[model samples]
Target chain A: MSGAPATIKDIARLLGISVSTVSRALKDHPDISADTKEKVNETARRLNYRPNALALGLKSSKSNTIGVIIPEIVHFFFSSVISGIEDAAYETGYNVMVCQTNEMYERETMVAKALLDHRVDGVLVSVAKTSTKFDHLTLLQDNGIPLVFFDRVCAFIETDAVVVDDYKGAYMASEHLISVGCRNIVHLSAPENLLIGKLRKVGYCRALEDNNLQVDPYNIYLCDTSEKVEEKIGRILDRHPRPDGFFAVNDSTAIAVIQHIKKAGLKVPEDIAVVGFGDGPVATICSPTLTTIEQNGYEIGYEAMRFLLDRINKGITAIVARKKVFAPVLVKRESTARRFENR
Target chain B: MSGAPATIKDIARLLGISVSTVSRALKDHPDISADTKEKVNETARRLNYRPNALALGLKSSKSNTIGVIIPEIVHFFFSSVISGIEDAAYETGYNVMVCQTNEMYERETMVAKALLDHRVDGVLVSVAKTSTKFDHLTLLQDNGIPLVFFDRVCAFIETDAVVVDDYKGAYMASEHLISVGCRNIVHLSAPENLLIGKLRKVGYCRALEDNNLQVDPYNIYLCDTSEKVEEKIGRILDRHPRPDGFFAVNDSTAIAVIQHIKKAGLKVPEDIAVVGFGDGPVATICSPTLTTIEQNGYEIGYEAMRFLLDRINKGITAIVARKKVFAPVLVKRESTARRFENR
Candidate 1:
């Protein structure tokens, strides 16, 4: 029962006729005799033959599928973005083909090339954290396929992108801690390779400078998202007096800092205050709750997909490659509840 | 440059020949002269023409794409399942097109028809929590396309499925609470319309009955995953004497019980010990961490895909639909730490 569809060859074999004749008869060509057309149409109906859509795509070379590449789908932020993409694509009557690189550079390159080979109408990407190369992306450009980057993006290749205001979000985080009378703050940061990391660090430093507090390089410790953040924070605390405040790059890192400080016999927002970016669900679930920045993942995803579809319709040459940025909102919670006692 | 791929007509227009002549030339037919073949190939290379793989699929009728439908991807459990599905699909040279129903029955049915119209080679489904009517699933079966259900399944439909041992998992949850010297327990459960909901209730009751404890009908409380669990638990506790033990259907509900208990001036483990199913991340993040059951989401996902692939390869006639179940593991955490002093 599970065999190839009834091709012209199958019909020709059944009717003892040429393949071309069978094909022409099915299409009701005038060259085909009425008797032959009747036999072909009856047999085709009996065999439940529905002409494959792929055949039409082969002739036109348009699959109506958009390729979507992401670091991973199991993550909270990225998954929310995917939900948004799915919703937007549904409205446009487009199907989405999803590929996960698992945050590896080699896999990202391989999938990108494979997508090009598949002749996907357009591609939406959030590059892997390990990705530093742009050749694979340039290949898509060469293929004349529209490409849009959201969140984790490549600066070397110019394209339309959707991103949250990371610098302003970080500035608001630090400023909130300062408003609560905290000085001697430790800023947990990500590696400078990521644009957000650099932007967030710049915001933190600028906030401290604007408040007339000396910006200390030692206080700004660079951390990797993949490494042991709690250990890094512990080491920093062991060497320096427990800072009165902490500003982490993300809520997870901020939660880790809160856990580590608690284990070190310190109380949250009492002995030491803390703040984080990305007001994800974990922010509300954690004890003493996380005070962080909400980046609106759904909106980010919807805007990204909409931007990609627009680029596809506008054609690559006409695309102005606009970058749309949204501001992040500060969500104050129990983690940074009050002014420090000694302040 | 956003245009369709060069067709046989394009080559014919360029060379002043019939469309069939260009097609014959590209196919290297003996009737076509060497010069015509060379011209067609040269022009094709210049235009970077790619044969629509779908066109070949139309001729043979195998798209090699599997349609995957899930409730939502933002959820930790479902997202893990998708990750597993993606990894498995990649190994089998299959691409997955994902659809999210957002837990709506009407949306689920609509997506199902859409996937069928897309003519997917096969389908893998984890039905929405709200899915009760299954004509949509039956439609796939009627169409002769292979179908497999995972986790949340359609009980009325006869199809291959993968599930965890809900009965044993719930039994173990209750037994653990009993071993910790808990009596007069309350059980939080899912809507009875779901098979797992009924199975879990049976297990909980059996555990209590075997231990010579009274199985009061009033002890069972129906709860929805989307409802306010804190209010439900509070109302249950208000009218009756607080139970010495509590068993929740999932980790989130268990967490809610813990949070509510804390607000009610009761210390977890010290006052009313509790256990939950699905040892998700929230189980560890919640203070007085949840003691729960761990069903391997990735394994469930991998197994579901493997089963679906087997069905797809074997054809519709050979598929003897089966339900594969795996045992759930119990994770001990702070929520069920101390033994009752009265014991």
Candidate 2:
């Protein structure tokens, strides 16, 4: 009969044990004898026994999955963060449902709804650029779903979040440039609407004000593209009394500035010292190596998932408004060294 | 009563419409009038009418979620591929469950089982380094689950796969190095067990044979880094009669080689030219920007999903297996140029 179906009764009859004892042994219950449990497990493997997926699903209202929504996954920083999250979640027997919003509010909302409709146990979100509203997020929370935000968080929602201290990271970057004897510092910024962008700007302003340097609006160029930053840096160099230092929100833009400086027959650190946020792999490979603020994206992701699991396991009904801020450390590299040393 | 339990009947009563019309309007049936649909939709929104997740789950017996398992997420190539997958899946009303195997076979099996237990509608997989067996994957297929393999795929599994032309890409990279006047070219290889690694080595050998260069066993370095590849590269460089040209299997290792070369007081492309696979952002930002093979990771992901969707929609059970291979293009940067020119 194709190696008789190994039900609890079959196992009990074979082992001369009670059916309840056989079942407990199969489950590794504390009450079962160690030898019996081992034998049951070995026999089950030999029989090629398979558990019922539907029964498990019915017993646990949870699909054992958490949904994650991000703007994009191609960026170096975001990928590292996802690695960290995946590692943590895997350890806890949880899976992640990843969706990309493509920086569109409608798509983000649709993704959230779809995840909810899938009955995902919890959610971890990094809002899209276009997500100025949080009605979609509220819908998830209103259904008693545990939600956690990391990196790009929505300020309108009340929930746990893991974010780097962008203000301090940006401040330290600017301060490093200042310490390197650069005065006319230019801050290449992101779209000024997001909280991260705003915080970074505040940090830049504080650093300049602390150094008794005038915060010129002209010095703060707003652009999203690295190509635009390169072009903007070129134009800035052509202007009278060119900036001696630059701080960018990311390594891509900082690398572009370095390329532009070299094209202008200028030297890094010697001619224009620069610093960037997020000490990603690009920051190290850049010629002269970028002296930037290291945001521990891995840690942020790990902690975000941990916080989410905590809420999920506890059956959290109310949105617990808490912000877990990770401090950013400055990684000093060759890009922002003292003037007139190498040349 | 707080509200007369607003349903299709209540909506019809309030709008002076039939229950069928209200239901059709809610579903946005093509036959329903646009004005009626809009009015019913607005009323449903105002009344906080939401569909039952469990009821929908029962009707479709599909979660509308796809599982994605990868070896690692921190790699730039994988992340970009995931972005493409996310884009395509979101467009088709599917969410992705992301899991990482960390290159461990056991973890891969665990993740596959977990995804199946979660009842994901389908799966996209990139096999892990230690995965030589296809038992876990075969199990998914046995259970009537749709599975698609991308990047690193298994030969035994008869399923849809999306992969790059690794052999051709490696041949092109090696040929380019030869054309640039390098007689001795060394290949820095990954673990020689996997299909991609073996294919790349074959391509490298093909190029050397075409150029009438002897295939020296010493020229091929097997990199098995306990943690990092930098130390391995260092040892390779310290050997006698250092190769005039080098090709790495991936960008991370290639970047590490660049750092080591600089530390050894050698210049890139001039002292020893180098080419890397995977045209990641690191390739662009690295000193003397790396020349490498650019794989369309996003396209691979998008197409893999499309193939799986086709299978799902067509109800094709156990059809002839198919393989889709994408060609990798060459991206020339400063790292492989005959003369180092800053632009």
Most accurate candidate by DockQ: 2
In the range B84-105, model 1's lDDT, one tens digit per residue, is: 8888987787777889999889
lDDT (C-alpha) at residue A342 in model 2: 20
lDDT of 2 by residue, B1-343 (tens): 1212245666778888998898889888999989999999988777545553444544565666778889888878898888888888878877787888999999999988886665567889999888888888877766567789998877788789999999999999999888787777889887666778888999999999998989999999876331356657777777777787888898877778878888889998898998999898888888878999998889999999998887767553745678899988988887789953322
- Which residue pairs in candidate 1 have backbone atoms (N, alpha carbon, C) closer than 3 angstroms, thus clashing? A54-B54
Candidate 1: RMSD to truth: 5.8
For model 1, the DockQ equals 0.35
Q: Which window of ten consecutive residues has the lowest lDDT sum in model 1 chain B?
A: B48-57
lDDT of 2 by residue, A104-202 (tens): 999888888887665677898888877778888877876667899998877777789999999999898888888878888898887766788888989
CAPRI class of candidate 1: acceptable
DockQ of 2: 0.38
Judged by whole-model lDDT over C-alpha atoms, candidate 2 comes out at 0.80
